[model samples]
Target: MASTIVSSIGQGTGLNITEMVDALVSADTAAKKAQITRQTNNNTAMISGVGSLRSALTTFQDAMKKLNDSSAPSFNAYAATSANESVVKVTSGNSAVPGSYNIVVKQLATGSKVASQQFAGGSSSAITSGELTVSQGGKSYKIDVANGATLESVRDQINKELGVQGISANIVNGDGGSRLVLSSTTTGAGSDLSLSGIPELEIDGTQQMAGSGAGYITAKAQDAELTIDGLTVKSAKNTIENAVSGMKMELTGVSTQTNGVGNPTSVTVAQDNEGLKKSVQAFVDAYNALQTTITALTSTSKDENDNLVLGPLTNDPTTRSLVGDIRKVLSEVGSGDQLTTLSQLGINTTKEGTLEFNSTKFTAAMNDKKLGSEVQELFTGTNGLFERMNKAIDPYNATDGSLATRKANLDKVAKNLEDQQAALERRTESLTESLTKKYVAMDTMVAKLNAQANQIKSVFDAINAQAKGS
Candidate 1:
């Protein structure tokens, strides 16, 4: 506002002092401001480029992790199939040998359940509260009931006191008013559930009504009984793992028995050629995507008008170094039984820095017994392809890694630019203030000179007018 007043004053002398001062100040600061803006924009782009590169690396790593199913890598994967899915379902790991087994499910494992005698009142009826001991599979826990506990409240208390140990209680209301039902998730023989407490909830046959009025066993605990290759096997759960080597079976239903013999379901274990091919193809695709991201960040393109447009990280030393490191790992040779490098397994890097996978070659390699193991070792063994690639990327993507340090430095640069911008603003304001004061003083002087000249002209005009009149 003061500058505006000064400018108005300077205008009285027919000099645009405000415009002249603005032109001078802009000329003096334009170059520095442009340079700072250009550098700040470039730094921001570089930071964003770093993040994109990191995200691409993380995505590639996820694809690689899928191939590593366990601590001991098993790229030579296996699959198991059951002839009758309604009878059983099977899954296999790489450690399983290719073979066929006859499986017959005779019985499924079930948990035990006990029910208290029907209460004369409904589920909301009050029950005697006392210390109750719940026993399942020989494991026991005691629960203290509040004096005013109802049937439903007692059931809730039992569930609250017992967590994942698998003991639970519920009230079943039927023609027999309401009964407290106790159930267990622990399946198998010798795991029956029993309770000893007030006569209303006892099931151990100790109370006078234990035989009839007390609770009675509704379902008895029993183990899953099955036959594998003519041998009987027992398990506490329907899903049996230890019955087979590197394979597990989940029993869905019992097989139909004929003349005292249960029909058997055929289970076959074999190499999963299709699954392996898909995994390798996924790896190739992920790496190619990462390569494309790197190219977009580090290469330049042309605009519609034929002007060159620079990429975010164009000519960046760190990006070039990272690309070189990954390429070096991909080009390494390996020692294997029948394969040496990725090329032997139908995987090769194209000139554009992306991998190409040959499905036919991969399938043939997997079909060969000796080559299959070699292919597995090439990708999952010590210093394998993925291992080396992950190692090379860790330094750049880790929390305190190269990319983090670079971003921090760029942030500092941005902060410094902010400081520079502030300083420039202060300098410009000061220059404007000084120039405005000078112009205002000059304007005041001009006004005084004009005033004196007008007074002199008035006196001279009066003299001339008097002479003319004479």
Candidate 2:
């Protein structure tokens, strides 16, 4: 006796469920990996934005500090001391006689010293009581020197040597030519020349000295005391070029006849406080622009996505961080009792983080004897505010500094992203392989089920036919 058994499963189905599931899983994995990569990019961008804001803020603060410091705007000048020394005297011109006359010296020409051989011929001496000749560029000059001639006579002979060299030889007229004098038409190191033969006897009334080339007497302005707005300024240069910008004062009415020693000339320097005011205002304007930029970066707004567009990272945290950093750098605290803060120097910030200048307040601060001195010390000291600020931001400079570090970090992150992407691609390939195998198995199973169903139907049809024939 045989028992009947029933089973149902197989055939060419409309779709393969197993293959579909595998494909969906692979797609989900790829999308997740892509999402992680995008987040990394966003993080890198945010870091860059914050770094840029910090740098700009630092620069703005530095400029403001320099402008606020009162000492930064001061100027120096040179004053004339000697009235007669200021004038050049042409005692004896080539065409004029040697006479005493009050001659104004527009420019003083420094004298030079030249050395040349005085040839002499005799039975006892190699050469004696002969003329020494010098030639250059087809031009020559003869110097007459007597045998056993003194150094002064030899210098005098060479002094008389004349040609393209445009040099004049003479005794320092006042010093009885005691000092041999050589003068060049030009001023420079190459203008002077000297030549020697034997023994190089001391000439020019001085030890035989090498030619100093061409040189000049540094005619500096005499020190003069001038009162500017009740402030006395002493300068040693003739023209007061910096007494006021664009306005130069020439020292006139100088007592040319008198030997201007211990003589004081009085002149007034008008104060241009208006010009100083304008400069301060310009600095304020620049500072305001920097503040605006920082504010914009840190602001956020809601978008259609119902998400914060800029977020707190843009407005609160980054901007606040920058403000804190700037304030810390500018604030002073030490035993030296130097500058304390911008406000102490009359540069106070508003609620909006922009600087405001109060002239009355600033003037009062400057007038404060102790405070003013302290403020001055801050700008020129061992550990001044500017020095500290520069030290802080120096690393951000383009060459092997903070900026370089940031750039290096960015490169490292980019490389990491690339590596992650490559890893994801490998994962995806593995997923694809698994999905393909699963789909192939599903396809085979469906085919076999359909064949089994067809076989069962054919058997039932043949059995029915036999039964009918019976």
Candidate 3:
């Protein structure tokens, strides 16, 4: 019956009721749908903009941290280079004075290797069970040998127990059967291997201890010997540190000439001016990137139709205040004899509100003998410019700070918008269902009245036909 009514609906009303119902529903919900769409777009864009702003702030802070490192501050950086890298390598710190040094690598440090007396019975030869004490490099360790332990077992025990102490033992096969060889990683003089209570394994006179068994000294321990500017220097290791203040020198090869005098490898230490400049440039670039982000967030522009388009954060006071705070810090002067502010370092604010780096001016200022060292005080230490800049940005960029709170609020607003949009869709669906039902009923009623009228007209036509036939 409902299908019949649906088929006859347009027969009576001569109208597309389904199409009309859809149009009515669309008209009823258009304004609210459009409003929700616009607001959702706005909230989503705002959330994204806040994320971008926070990321930019973090990047700028990273740049600040690079310059403000308490250890090896960027401004006080020094470079040490060796003329002959094959013979020597050098590293310098801020405390090193700028000067040239004639370095000569005479001999590197050596460790001890000892070979025990050969056993005719080879690796499986029986060894006495006792506590064996091994000493080397001012350190000692004792290993317990079980009864009925072979030479191989003792060697394994020595390697297992003494390996961590920089001493190891291995068995070598020669004409005299298997000989146990013990070696030490400990270098420098008076650090030769010494053994006690293991006469079966000991050779003779390795350590020259009175009334003590010894081992064959395959290699003797020796200290590393070198010279700086013809001044003699000795070290326990190839890497020498205390010879020069704030400098570490590594001897790689011997450079003793035929005339009995060692050839010199020139090492030069200087302030790292170019490296500091690069660091400064990176700082400037990071700040500029942050400035660009802020400008994009707070500035307005024209759309394709000439309509004014507002940025996601155009009306946000926090963004503007944050930029103002950073600018205020940058503008302040510092207490330095040769440098007071970043402007003196050739970092100046442009009309666009971003920093412009003048490399030539920076180079000249950094090269000035009086100003070069003084510049270190400006960008380093507790009162440095980078530290100040970091402090200025801390309030906004920290966790639970202004930007985080702003982002949280924007996210909440976005969630609210989503809820509103869902509620609107439900209302639209309810309204559409109601309107469709009412229009369908009205169409069915009109169709029934037309059917009744057709029945009456047909009855009259039949009567008239009968009369005409008579």
| Highest TM-score scorer | 1
What TM-score does model 3 achieve against the real structure?
Answer: 0.76
lDDT of candidates 1 onward, in order: 0.81, 0.48, 0.80
Per-residue lDDT tens digits for candidate 3, residues 1-470, read: 22323442365677776677668878988998999899889988888888999999998888777677655466655788999988988887657788899988888888777777767899999999888878776666888989999989999999998888888889887775777778878778777887777778654324532222236454477888888998889988888885888788878888858688778989998978887788788788888999999999988999999999999889888888888999998898877775788887789999999999998888878676345565666776557777788788888889978889988888888888889989988887787677766777776788899999989999999999999999
- Ranking of all candidate structures by their lDDT, best first: 1, 3, 2
Sort by TM-score, best first: 1, 3, 2
Query: Relative to the unseen true structure, what is the Cα RMSD of model 1?
Result: 4.1
lDDT of 1 by residue, 357-466 (tens): 98877777777644654556677677778788889888887888898898899899989988998998887888877877787788888899999999999999999999
The model with the greater lDDT, 2 or 3, is 3
Query: What TM-score would you give candidate 2 relative to the actual structure?
Result: 0.49
Tell me how many clashing residue pairs each candidate has: 1, 21, 1
Clashing pairs in 1: 209-214
Clashes of 2: 21
**What's the lDDT for candidate 3?**
0.80
Cα deviation of 41 in candidate 3 (Å)? 0.8
Off by over 4 Å in 2: 1-11, 16-23, 26-35, 54-105, 108-268, 282-301, 309-322, 333-341, 359-385, 395-407, 455-459, 462-470
Q: What is the clash count of model 1? A: 1
